[model samples]
Each structure stands twice: as C-alpha cells, then as structure tokens.
Target: MTSLELQRTNLPEGLEELLGPKGLLTGEEAREYGRDFMGEVDNAPLAVLRPETTEQVAEALRLCTEHGLSVIPQGGRTGLTGAGVPSRPDHEVILCLARMNKVRWLDEKNHAMAVDAGCILADVQKAAADANRLFPLSYGAEGSCQIGGSISTNAGGTAVLRYGNTRDLILGLEVVLADGTVLDMMRALRKDNTGIDLKQLFIGSEGILGVVTGAVLKLYPAVAERECALLAFPSLPAVMKSFAIARESTNDRLSAFEMMPQNGITLACNRVPDVVDPVEGDYPWYALLEVSASKEGSGLFEMLEGLIERLMEEGLVVDGTVSSNEGQRAQLWRIREALVEAHNDMPHLLKHDVSVPISDMADFIETAIEKVQAIAPDAMLIAFGHVGDGNVHFNICHDLDTPDGSLATRHKEVTWAVYDLVQEYRGSFSAEHGVGSMKRDALRRYRSEAELAVMEKLKTALDPQGLLNPGKVI
Candidate 1:
C-alpha cells in the first residue's frame, strides 16, 4: 500500500489538532530525516513527525499504531547502523524527538538526574559537572548524539571499563510501547529488587521495542584528579598485557584506555588538522590510558607512573608519554578523536565495530588483520579504539589512489571476509553500533535460531501490532 494511503486509511482523526501544523512535515522536508550519520545507504520516509512532549510522542505513536503505519524512531541520526533511517519506501513515518530536549530535574544527593530523551549527551555531562558530579557517558558523538539514542543502543564508550555502558548508567526509563501505551519506569532508586526489570527490554532494543522519551540516569562523584598517558606497545598482545598491570596498579583508577596502531595514528595526524603526534619514537602499537580520582589526595599520577614502570619492566610497553596538564592531555586525545575524520576522504573504508573476550582481543585483531590482508592486500588498515572494553574499530580503508569504482565496490567483499572471521571467535560484528537497517541482514545470519526465537517472543508480547520503529534492531 502507498504510505499516504495506509496512514490516511488507518490513522484516526484528532491527532493533527494535538500536533498542529508546526509538528508535521511532508515531501522534501521529510527527506533529510530519512538518512543516518554515514550515508552508507539512502532511504526515505513518507512523513516526519516532531513531537515536543512525551504525551505528544505517545499520541503520535497511538495514531501510528491505529494506522498500521511502520514507524522509525530518530534521535540525532548519528548512529552508524542506519537504524534511524526507514528501510521500506511505503507505510513508514519517521518520528523524531529532537524537540523534546529538556532536563526534568536533578537529585544531587542520590547521584541521579532525570532528563528528556532529546538532551544531548555532552549537555548532560556538562550539567552533571555543574552540579559537582560526573556523568561519564561520553563518545565521539557526544556533541550531537542524544541521550535516548545512547540508551536505546546501550552505547559503550571509552570509560565503559570503569563506568559501564549506557544500560548500567540508566536507573530508569520512560518508554512508549507499540500500542502507544506509556511505560513509566522512571525511578532513581539504586537498589530496588523490583519484579522483572522491564527497562532491559527497551535498552539496547534500538527502538524496536519502544520509543524512549525520558530517563533517570545514575551519576557519579566528580573526578578531581586525573592522569593521562600514551604508551607504545609492540603488538596487540603487549597492549593487553600492559592493561592487566595497569589495572592491578594505582588501585584500578583506570577510567579510559584506548589502543591504536602507529599507522592509524599517522593517518589521524595527516588527515585531521590540529591533531599532532606527541611522541617521537617509532612503535607499531600505542595505547592512551586515563585514570581519574574523586579527590585531590588520590596520588593518581604516581600510581600511573608505577603502572607504567611495572609494565615497562615486564617489556609490555616500549615507550610512554605522561601528560602533565589538562591541555596536553586534551591534545593527546585529539589524535584519537581525529581518527574518523582522518579517513573521511579515504575510499572504500570498511569500518567494523567488533568485540570478543578481553583475553582474546590480541589474537582476534591479529587474525582479523591477516584475513583482511589476504583478501585485500592494498587496503590501508587503520584499526583502533576502546581496547579496555575489547571493542575495536577495525577500519579497512581502500587507498585513495586506488583505481576508480573498484575500491568502492569491494566494501561488501572485505566486510564479509572480516565479519566471517570475527564470528569464528564468537565476537559481535556490531558492538556499540546497533543493527540498524544496514546490519539487520547480518544479524539474521549471525544470531542463533534459539536466540532469535526469544527475541521474536518479546517482540510479539510488547509490539503485537509491530507498528513502533518497525524496520529497526530486529
């Protein structure tokens, strides 16, 4: 059926009065919201609805449910998985929460804060800092990605090893179910042995289960003292070894730990402006370590020094650069941040966000690298990222100087080859990134039948109509 026909035939009246003209967009106005962060694919929605209030969102969903129109939930559209974009041409409407950016309240004493779904992640962090607390859900998309999107994807960032993923940070959530029923699970209690944590259904569901409207997030004491260091390792195994010694030392104050190859660092320096290498020594692999403390007397630097010294003694780390000040530390991280942009111009880059057991990270990377090389010899390899959580962005950049359309066409081949190897290790191909429309097929192939059967049961129970964010996550 045509989208307009399906919506018009099924949607009940009176919703337009509640939303008004300003909240609705059709035709070209709806085209932009139909794409994702990376233009890996292009898909459009029939209409776009921007709801300002939770009630409005629920109301919209209820109308959508009645119409049997497939809905797409959109946040900042910074998701790499193409989850936000509509897959089918007909019977789809993109519902965006960008208008609902609001911080409901703050409970400093309880270390919790309630915020609307549309609030930018960085803004939440800044607000927590203003309250003399820490909201450590950070990532490359902090500036634009919405808090709801993070919780929906259950995002894991740099500090996940210490602070945990978005699911851990979320104490409670407000979700709009498939039938437009509002599930108010927004409680700030830390230890509530409630019957069946329903929040788990929506978290990491990637909008398939429901539309996340508001959340109660867990906060932490502000970090007062921090030590940042960049260490050079011979290989991924050495990097993993260094991580163990560092974790044991300094009482495990480790906050963020990232590992990258020298070639990746060079790409960041060359491609992104203002990102320069801090050290001179040549090394195959390097790690950026960050340790933080709540009080001034933590002696974090000394502890970091002890860890580095111990790792060096064990021949785990070959070279190390300890940042003395915040400015220097920010500069050191700029290299890491610039990595994506560094390859912005590269042709046919296959970016894989995969995770295996922490113990098997080194071997996984080595094996994956070898397989990718065998398949595409000239592919410029720039693999790096949150090594602390065993999540790595294994980017295979087909050289810019490569011949014509050949490089761009090899994306499917290279991705399949690498993902096949990643699956052999029981590793997830989509780690922090959810299986948006882009990875839905991959997920179908990867997930075991038993696992998928459970998911199907949940979908049937929660979204019997299958009207809420229809073409996503599942």
Candidate 2:
C-alpha cells in the first residue's frame, strides 16, 4: 500500500469511529468509485465512504467538514456529465450511496413510495409494479442508476412527454447539508403550499447544495393497455408535424414520442446484438411512439390505428410498423434504447444534449446538419432523441475515411458551431443532462449573470466552507 492508503486507513479523529471498517474503502477497493461511465476523465480519490444510514451519512459529513476534507457525493456513476466524479480526486472523499438502498415504506393511500437515495430505479419500478402502481421515471440506466442521482440530475427520459421529469415524480426529499445537518422534508402530500418547498432546492442542484439521502416519489396507476409503433417519415418536417398530431390526437395518452434518424437506427442494428430493425427499407427519419391507457378498454389500439391511417393519407409517414404483442413492443423499444450503446464504440465522437422550441426543431436539425457537414465534411451525423419534448441528442462521428488528427483539430470549432446554432434558435445547450465539470464552461458562457449570481449565493449560504462536491454545477 502507498502512503496515501495508510493515511486514508488512519483517518482523522472521529471519522474511523463513526464509519467502521466496511463503511470506509481505500486503495484498490475505492479506486473504481473515482472513475465515471465514460472513461474520458479519471480522478482517483483519497478514499470511498459508504454510509448505510442517514445518521451515518450525517456523522461522516460532520467529521469531514471538521477535518476540512472535500466530500463528493456519488450514486451509480451512470451520468453523461461528470457530476458524480471529482476533479481533485486526491483530496476528495467519494460518498458512495450503495449501502443505503432500501424501500422504507409504500403509502398506498397517498400514492407514493418513500425510498432511500441509493435504491435502484429499476427496483423502485418493480416495487411499484408489485403494488399494482407505476413509477414513471423510465430511462436506459434504470437498471443501475440510483434514485438520488436521478433526483440530483433531474433526469429526463422517454416518459417525460407523459409523466414529466424526475422532479415531477418526486414529492419530498431528505437531504444532508455540508455541515452534517439533516433537513427532513419527507412529506407525502401533493398540495403543500406552505412557503417555499425546500425539497425543490436540491432536486436538480447536482449535490452542489447538499446530498440527497432519501426521497418520497409520486406513483401513478399502472397502465392496463398500451400500443407501440415505429413510423418512417420522408423528412424531418413530417416527424415534427406527426409529433404535433400525436399530442393533439392521443387524448393525452401518449407516453413516449422518441425520434431516430436513419443513421442512428443503422448504427444500432449493426453494432448492438439482438437489436433488429423494426421497419423495412430506410427513410430519413423515424419515430417510436407509445400510447398507454390506465383502463383496459380505453380503445388506445383503435385510436393509434386511426392516427396511423390519417398520417399515411396525409403523406406524413411513408412506412410504419405497429407492435401486436408485448414481445414485439419490447423489441421495438430495444432499438431506441440500444442507440447510445451502439454509438459508444465510435473511435471519435462529439455528443450534445440540446433542446429547441418544438416549432423550430425541424429547422434547427436541417440547418445544424448543413453547418456540421460543412465543418467536418467526412463526419456522419447521428441525431435522435425525444422530439415531443424538443430534446435532441445531436451527435457526430468521424468518418472512417477521415485522416487521423483532423477531427481532433476541428472538435472545438464543430462544437461551438452546433451550440451557436442552438443558441440562435433560443434553445438550451444543456437539456436533461446537468452541467457537470465537462459543461461548466458552457454553463458559464450560456447561463445569465443574474441566474448564476443567485446560484452562487445559495451555494455560499449552504456550503460556506465549499467542501461539498467542489467545482461542480456552479
């Protein structure tokens, strides 16, 4: 072991006493926590702290504060942004919430479930399903992501069009401040109009304000019937027009309106195993839409059929495929879910999670494609995302024919051009993905001065010593 390992094992004062041998991890045992999902940034921390209970977390925080040790709160480490990982890892203690995974109780009357922050989202969804209810915070990382990280980042996924973001699914939160003080606001009430809702402060703060230890998440009635369809569009305008029509025609039952380009689907079909194309032939754009009803006999299938027929007649959709059973529906959804995993194999790729006004999405895509092609002529664009919510995962990959170092030289220019166009259209550069260290500069460039000032003031007020997740999210 190195001198750092010895020092970490021999922690300062009350820390070792509060957190036992299993709670504290050092050297190799703690090394993996320092790395994130994408291996682009690596920061080996001093130690990894695992506190099983809220009291344990509080004591750890209090001890760290007293000893002047920086604490970086981390969850499943599935975030695209570097929020869970630390910049100054040698001096930071990663507060991993792995041990706090537990469901405290299910309030059937209140239609909510109180869960520890470390609870896996998939487990929560399963629990809700067991109770004959639904937890609507669906995402690709549901199998691994913890509730705390989801709440911290305010994750947006396919279900955002219907159930809203993670913020909407949460009713209350129990957080621990930098000084180890516990702010318990775990109320399972929907109509709490008493002053400012304290839980909202830490919802999307990304652990900059404090660590979320527990949450009371809102639940909904489980869907009894649903329909899934994959439709091919001749152009981007047709996709946007179809989105508007879907929203207006579905009677508010449309759960997901995910868009994918031909290249994106091609990438998934070619790279990811067991992910076959749902439709025949190729089109410029496609949409994987779902309409679900809580009642069994809600006529959702009939409604979808009528919508598809009308779209065909209007020349909006050139080709389409609808799922007749659960197996087919899951297969259709897999194509969309595997897109990110497929693109993960690219040698050099640039990713941007941005959102534009629903009305300007088509124009933004057309103009961005032209501009990006001009910047990197050999680059292949793979743009797709939740077009219903106006969030697009505008991404590009270096063509195999391009010479090495060419993309590296033009990376910055291409990024700036894309963001500039997004800004020109009055869209957000960072949509669902929070501003972690990777996007800190972008946040500074795009965010308003007054808004940043308020965030800084709040940070100072909460973490006066600046020891909690330093250099993250304002």
Tell me, by lDDT, which candidate is best.
2
- What lDDT score belongs to each candidate, Candidate 1 first? 0.85, 0.90
Residue-wise C-alpha lDDT for candidate 1, range 1-474, written one tens digit per residue: 865455444445666677778787766677888777787756767778888999999888888788777888888989888888788764588888888899999999999999999999999999999999999999999999999999989999889989999999999999998688899999998888969999988999989898999999999999999989999987778899888777777576899889888988888887788888888888999999999999997888788888888888888888879999999999988888887788866877677898888888989889888887777777788889998898899988876667655435677888888788889888899889988777877888899999999998999898898776776667
TM-score for each candidate, following the candidate numbering: 0.95, 0.98
Candidate 1 weakest lDDT stretch, 10 residues: 3-12
Cα displacement (Å) at residue 53, model 2:
0.6
Give per-residue lDDT, candidate 1, residue 72: 86
Candidate 2, residues 1-474: lDDT per residue as tens digits?
Answer: 877657575555777668888988878888888888888668988888999999999989998898888899999999888889888657788999989999999987779999999999999999998998999998999999999999999999989999999999998899999999999999999899999888999998889899999999999998899999999999999999999999999999999999999988988898889999968888999999999988999999899999999999999999989999999999999999888788876857899999999999999999999998887877888899998999999988875556664556698888889999999988998889888888888888888999999999999999999999888887
Q: Which regions of candidate 2 deviate over 4 angstroms?
A: 1-5, 401-406
